[model samples]
Target: MSWSGLLQCTAVEKNGRTVISDCYYEGALKLTRPVYLHPSQPTIYLIHVGGGYVDGDRYKTEIMLQEGAHLIATTQSATKIYKTVKVPVQQYTSAYLDDQSVLEFFPDPVIAYEKAQFYQEMTVYMKESSTFIYGDIITPGWSESGELFRYDWIRSKLKIYYEDNLKLFDHLYLETSTGMTGIFQMEGYTHFGSLFVISPFMTQDLLQKFESMAARFPASVHLGWSIPMIPGLVIRVLAHETHAIETIFQMIHQFIREECFQEEPIFLRKY
Candidate 1:
C-alpha cells in the first residue's frame, strides 16, 4: 500500500521519574524532544507508531534513545500487508540507542499472506552500561482457512555496537517451499521467533538458566541459547503455533523482569 499515514510515540524516564507523550500521527512522526528518567525510577516507556499499509509497497519507522534512558517500544499490533495484484509488501524499521541507555524492541509477530515478502533490519549502538532486548515473530503464511505454507521469503538482521567488545552480531534468513523438513530449520513448523539481549553482565550461568527455561516448552518447538561475543545471551525458537511463540516470548520477558528489573524502580506500563 502507499505510505499514506504515520504515527510516532516517544517516552523517557530518569532516576525515579516518568514522562510520556501522546501518539503522534502525521505524514511522519519524529521525537525531537528527549525523554529523561531518574536513575532510581528504572521505568520502561513504550511507544507504538507506524504506517498502516494502503497501496504502496514501502513503509519506514525510526526510533531514537538518548543517554541514560530506558525505553521498551512496541507496535500495538502486527503489521498487516494486504495481498496485492502488483508487487510484494515491505516494511522498514530503524532504531538508535545511545550511551548508558536500555531499550527493548519487542513487537508482535508479523503474519505474511500468500506471496508476501518482508525484509527487516535493526541496528543498535551502545556506549557505557547500555543494555538492549530485541525480538521478532514471523509466520510462513496465514494458517487459518487451511492455507498451510505459502509465503515466498522472509529475512531479517540484528546488528549491534560495531565492536567485538561484546560479540553480539548475528543475521537470520528463512525461506519456505513445498520441500524441506525436520528439527534444525523449521522442522515442519510454520511460525518462528527470536530474542536477543545485549548487556554487560551476561555469563555462562545466565545462559544455562535461559536454556533450562526454554526446555520446559514442547519438543515441536526448537529452542536454543548462545552467548555470542557480545555481553548478552541469545534465545531463539521455532514453533508451529502462534500462541506457543507468544508464550515463549512472555516467558523471556518475565525472566528479564525478575532478573533485570528486580532492584530497579522502572515499571512495565501497559500499552
Candidate 2:
C-alpha cells in the first residue's frame, strides 16, 4: 500500500541517558521535541498534521531503540477517523527494542465517526531481556442522530515477538453490520480499552494487584485481565465513558513505573 505519511525514529543510550539519535518524517506524520520528564527516559509525542484521517489514507511508523535505552511514546491527541467514501483509513507500526531496553507506548483513543472505517496493526520485536508496554482505547465518535456505534467498523491487530518467536497475537474486529451490542460483543459498552505489558516483572503478584484494582470499579465498567503464555500481562476493559478505563490503566502504569522500574510516577504532561 502507498502510504500518505511515513515516520521513522531511533533512540539510543548516550552518556547514561536515552536520546533520539535519528529521525526522518514526511507528509502528514511528525513528532514533537523529545521531552525528558525523568532524566533517563525521553517522551515523544506523535502528531498527525492533517488533523484527521480521511478515506484512502495510509500511515506508517517505525521506532527503534538501541541496547540499554528506554523511551516513552504517545500521541498528541485522539485519532479521528472521518466518514469514508471509498475505503478505510489504514495504519501500520513496527517497533524494535534491543536487549535490556524498554518502550512504553501510550496513545490516545480512536474515534470512528459515522460511516467511518479504520484498520490498524502494530508489531513489536524485542529480546528476552527487554520490556514493552502498550495501551489503546477505542470510542465512538459523535453523530447528528446521537446514536452509539454508528461507525461502520474497526479492525485492530497487535503482535509481539520476543527472542525471535511470536509471544502474543491479538486481533479484534468490530463491525456495526454484525451487531456490536449482542452477546459476545461489546454488550452495550461504547468504549473499549486494552493494555499489554511484557516484562519480567509481570508475575503472579502483579496479577493480584490488578485484581484489587478491578474490585474498585463499579458495575458500569467491566475489567478483564489475564496472563498470557509469555511472561506478560494483558488487560481489557469495556465502559460507557473513556475516563473510567483510562483511570485504571494509568494507575497500573504508575505502579509498574515505581515498583518494577524503580522510577517516579511522572506525568506525560498532556496539559
Candidate 3:
C-alpha cells in the first residue's frame, strides 16, 4: 500500500459550463473523466484501483470549486473496508467552494468487514450562498458466523464552515465495546444513513414539504430530518435494507433537483 495517496481536483466555470481546471492523483486513488449528464453540472466518479481498503492504508481527496462552478462526485461502487489487525484504514476529504458554487457527493455505502476499523474526516469551506449536498450509507459487512456488527469500530467527523465561521460540527462514532446491539447502539437495525444539505435554497416551506413526504414512506424505514437551520439541515435514517433508505433519499434528491435547481433528477448512468 502507498504511504500517502492523493486525488486532487479543481473545477472552474467557463462559458456557463463547469470544467475541470486541474487534476492530479497517485497510488490507489484515481478519478474518472467528468461526464456532463447536465449541460452545466459535471459528474465525476472516484475509482479505487485496489477495489477495497485494507490495514494501514491512507487516502486523501481535495476538491476546489471556482466561482459559480458546480460538480457532482460519487464512487464507482461501494467502499469496502476489510479486516485489520493493527492500524485502521483512514480517509480524509476537504473541499473549498467559492461564491454560488455547488457540490453534490452521493457515494455508495461503506461496508466494514469482520475485525475492520475505519476512520474518516471531512471538512468543507464555502460561502453562505454556495450549496453542498452529501449523503451516504454505513453497513456491516458479512462474517463467517453471519453475525452483524463484526467490525471493530467505525468513526467519522465532519465540519462545515461558512466563510470562516463553523456552522456545523458532527461526530459519529460506533464501537463494539459499547455493545452494538444495545438500544442506544444499532438497536436491531442493520444499516444507518445520513443526508446533509447546506444550501441557500432550503427554506422552511421546503422543510415542511419534505417532512410530509417522508411521513408517507412505508413503516419499514425509519427516517427523520432536522428543522432547517436557516441554511442547513440534516436527515438520519435507519432501515433493515439498503434499498429502503436509498428510495427515500432519491425522492428527496429529486425534489431538490426539480424545485431548487429546476432540473431533472440526476442519473449517474453507471451501467
In each prediction, how many residue pairs overlap at the backbone (N, C-alpha, C within less than 3 A)?
A: 27, 0, 0
Off by over 4 Å in 2: none
**Local error of candidate 2 at residue 85 (angstroms):** 1.3
Model 1 clash tally, residue pairs = 27
The model with the greatest TM-score is 2
Error of 2 at 23 (Å): 0.4
Q: Which residue pairs in candidate 2 collide?
A: none
In angstroms, how far off is 98's CA in candidate 3? 0.6
TM-score of 3: 0.96
Candidate 2 lDDT trough over 10 residues, lowest sum: 210-219
Worst ten in a row by lDDT for model 1: 39-48
Ranking by lDDT: 2, 3, 1
Select the stronger candidate by lDDT from 1 and 2.
Answer: 2
- Model 3 scores worst on lDDT over the 10 consecutive residues at 221-230
Clashing pairs in 3: none
Residue range 1-271, candidate 2, lDDT tens digits: 5688999999999999999999999999999999988888999999999999999999999999999999999999989999988989999999999998999999989999999999999999999889999999999999999998989999999999888999799999999998999779999788999999999887888778767776876677888888898888898999999888888788889988976888888776386
